[model samples]
Target: MSRFSFNQITAKLWDLPDLVAGCVEAGVGQVALWREPVTEYGLERSAALVRDAGLSVTTLCRSGFFQAPDWFDDNRRAIDEAAALDTKVLVLVSGGLPAGSKDLAGARQHVADAIAELVPHAAAAGVTLAIEPLHPMYAADRCVISTWDQAMAIAEQHPVGQVGVTVDTYHLWWDDTVLDRIARAGERIAIYQLADWVTPLPQGVLTGRGLPGDGCIDMAAFHAAVEKAGYTGPIEVEVMNAELWERPGREILDATLTSYRKVV
Candidate 1:
């Protein structure tokens, strides 16, 4: 339980205060927050709420969409938010190709360049920018970084701790080469997120993730890889499913814990 962190998106409908209290009651000591909710609840207030409750903010959910015109400023603010929340890791989801553009190579290069520009700020803030590689299916409209190799290539360009990769099960399970890469990642692994991939992916394919044990992913294999990599950080349960979100918050948390225990 010490290593488990609940990502807020897993319980998307839960209000902030209730979610905090629920985690405390459930003996959940860590949580990964999303920017929208933190901003809506008032950042400082949310930080104090978690801090006062003795909860650790594992990582800020995300702050990279290089395709946006204001990405630089937005990501800078995200770094400040992570620092304010007293978290050391900020997840980066490199956005997909720009509208009317099909230059996959160019889009990927821009993500690397964007990270280089942000590394200094991230280092100064004592935060690690975790580049998350989404599944290849999302490459066109969600994330261009679609493999462990691509994420590592960009992260390796920067110093360890300043830049790293996010190993997410739902996104990487289909890649036969991912487990070995994750095993060799070492300190380059910034955060480890769990979500299984269910079949008949829904429209948009964004919220079709299953809990750890509900799909075809080999959670044990991923666990072994991260363990071999010496990652002793919090393991976050970050499932995103439309049906799951319809349940009550506490029920969601309970279900997530059950699913996690079966796999881990």
Candidate 2:
């Protein structure tokens, strides 16, 4: 339980205040927050809410989308937000190829370049920029970094604490080589997120994730690999199931914790 971090998106419909109270009641001490809700609730107020409740924020859900024209400024603000929330890690979902562009190689390079530009600011803010590699299916319109190697290649170019990789089970489970690579990642692993992959993926495929142990993913294997990597950081359960979201916030948290216990 000390290592469990409930990613806020897992209970997407839960209001921030209710989520905090629910977590406190459930003995959940850590969370991974999304920027939209934080901004909507007032960043400072949200920060104080969690701080006052003794909750530790594991990471800021994401801030990348390098394809956006305002990527630089937006990511900078994200860093500030993460710092203000008292979190040390900010996950980056490197955006997919630009519209009307099919240059996969070029898009990947741009993501790397964008990270290089942000490393200084992240380091100064005492935040780690965690590059998350989404599944290959998201390559066209969601995230271009689609493998552990790609994310590590970019992260390795910067210092260890300043840049690192995010190992999310739902996104990386299909890669046969991922577990081995993850075992050797060491401190380069910034955050470890859990979500199983169920068949017949839902529309958009974004909200189709299953809770840990609820689908086909080998959660134990991932746990072993991460343990071998010496990652003693928060383990975030970040499922995004449409059906799951329909449940009450407390029910969602309870279900998530039950699933997490079965796997971990």
Candidate 3:
């Protein structure tokens, strides 16, 4: 059976302990956390709590924002943290267009450069850099790595187990060639992320995602493709929406888990 987990980015505003507790209470067997939450409670403390709660730490939320000149230092810290917590994957959200820059290609180049710099650190820590490609709508300000093809290019260039792509359905459900890309990713797909895309897209880049079965994404087919791609990893539930947040945390958690087991 496939176990499901929560992506901390979806509940970005919750306190760290509360987030973990909610997931455990809602029967989530694992959690993918963000760095800020880890920083808040400290990695060791958070890891201990998660273990005490009988939950696995699936992966960390993200570690790559390759657009900054000082990104190296920050990435090293993230790697160190992941190592300490015994987490396996540090999901990398390749950064957006830098201010005043119209060059998407150039920004992508920066991502490549950063990955080149971080690979050794990540490899040393035995942590994988899971590159998460955001949707094209966020092409300008969220992530330049917008396709599995682009992510595969980076992974092949690096050729390290410490580097692969994180597949998020909300970011990629609309892709015409998704099934093919999923097949291509195969073993290199490090993380399988799920979230529903509702109509009337939200204004801000982050908070529009609906829960699985709450939108029109063919999630069952998506799961089939993921399984066919040889990825048996936990399917990470990552919903970022104002409506979900406004509802009780337990309710959202229950709904997300139910939808994944039933619809996805």
lDDT of prediction 1:
0.95
Q: What is the C-alpha RMSD of each candidate to the true structure, in Å?
A: 0.8, 0.6, 1.6
Q: What number of clashing residue pairs does each candidate have, in the order they appear?
A: 0, 0, 0
Candidate 1 similarity to native, TM-score: 0.99
Off by over 4 Å in 1: none
Clashing pairs in 3: none
On lDDT, the stronger of 2 and 3 is 2
Tens digits of per-residue lDDT, candidate 3, 114-133, equal 89888988998899988888
| Ranked by lDDT, top first | 2, 1, 3
Off by over 4 Å in 2: none
* Worst 10 contiguous positions by lDDT, candidate 3: 1-10
Instruction: Give the clashing pairs for model 1.
Output: none
lDDT of 1 at 213: 90
Candidate 3: C-alpha lDDT: 0.82
